[model samples]
Target: MDRIANIHTLTKRLIVMTAISLLVFSVIFGISYFFNGRLMMTWLGFVCGIIGGFVSIQQRIKNVSDEELTLLTNSWFQILLVPIFGGVFSLVLYCIFLAGIISGNMFPNFYIPKPSGSVPDANFMIELFTKTYPLTGQDFAKFLFWSFVAGFSERFVPQIVNNVADKSSEKVNPSDR
Candidate 1:
């Protein structure tokens, strides 16, 4: 009974901490979006991916055994790695989009604007934000959706990579016809 109560307490702590972490990252992303718009897509993708990871973990927690739940929630090392994994997968997805492997009403290209001063002026900062932001409103939503999907489904990017590899191999070693 005591152990079960402790597990429940730990689980609640995990949920609260993850929520706080998400809020913190959202604030960071908002602040950095314009200042570092050069990597805006990457940043957005990472944040979305982190959200996906958190959501996925939460869903799994519901269906898991108490032992598994305790292990998953208590393992800070594993929890910390979630964001890194999310970022990496999101980055790979961004690269794929940039490479024209995935195409839609999306802008895969970006240009960094030059600042007038060491600290960019407002117009220059606006220019920087406008130039580097690759998507319009709807398209950005799409990117966020896909990036979140990628993070939620661990197999998503790996499947894409495998598919690309298969295609590359076929191209390199064409069968005699």
Candidate 2:
């Protein structure tokens, strides 16, 4: 069994996340402000980070409850987070795609559908994507960036939350055991 998976091993994960988030947030915000003279990007990142924390908790619930691990390790719940994570990442990437294209002052070749569904008359979803996000150089770059960020955030969030949960739990010292 992975020691890190143990609830007692959470401190290190939290520490690492806190340090990395702080550093990354500061550097990105600084660069953005220097160029745009505004705190929008920084604020966005902070908000995303905080939201990411909650998302991480959700993932942790899934991780801790994984059948293979749960049977061997005592936990509080059971869930499959892969679909949830996929949905979240997809949305994140979509938003990033939109934001990046807009920022680059370029219209995407693809057309996203509105909630009404009447706005887009396409019969297929893939066709919709084809119409919405242009597979251009800038679009591809933005897509990659979004994928990387979303994936990193998703994968790490659970680890952070698990660590937090573990740290909060009462520890059983070896002498006591």
Candidate 3:
């Protein structure tokens, strides 16, 4: 009877996790479609979301209760937030690289062309934000790679860091020390 109850509980958790994963992937796909209007971005977001969801569940599966699973699945919003923040961070870095404000081997060669006559302003920035660039296969691959990194690391990296910090801060016995 106990084994049966455990199986039932495990099944429920699996179903909930699957639903949350799909929800996360759909939201990502919708946002990417709205912004870029490219199938590649949609696919990239879907793959990233799945990878992120799997990583999250795998990390928590061993000790998670049904209630905790619900909470964790609901927190999948971080999957979206991380990638958006990462995209903004990448944009800022690209801008800084282009402006000659920071020059070194650290920055890649961003291929954005200089404006012919007018200086960039708020309007230009707005246009840049709304406009979808023509991405090559290599560029799309790089974008997807970064998206995966952002999504996968959103929760995983922080958890690992916290675990390491917590372990290090634990006091050792006088004899052990």
Highest TM-score scorer:
1
Off by over 4 Å in 3: 1-55, 58-60, 63-118, 132-135, 155-177
**Sort by lDDT, best first: what order?**
1, 3, 2
Clashes of each: 0, 6, 0
Candidate 3 per-residue lDDT over residues 109-150, each given as its tens digit: 334434434788776654454443324555555545544544
Error of 1 at 85 (Å): 1.3
> What is candidate 1's lDDT per residue for 6-86, written digit by digit as tens?
457556765775687778777777787666544456667877777777666656655767676666656776665665576
Residue pair clashes in candidate 2: 10-163, 110-131, 110-132, 110-133, 111-131, 111-132
Top of the candidates by lDDT: 1
Supply the TM-score for candidate 2: 0.32
lDDT, residue 16, candidate 2:
52
Those runs of model 2 whose alpha carbons end farther than 4 Å from true positions after fitting are 1-5, 40-55, 58-63, 66-177
Residues 1-177 of candidate 2 have per-residue lDDT tens digits of 564464333434434544665576578678866975654422443334444443455345445644544442442222123323533554544554454422444323333544346554545543443334445766544444444344436654345346645654636443453
In candidate 1, which residue ranges exceed 4 Å CA deviation? 1-14, 30-39, 65-67, 105-130
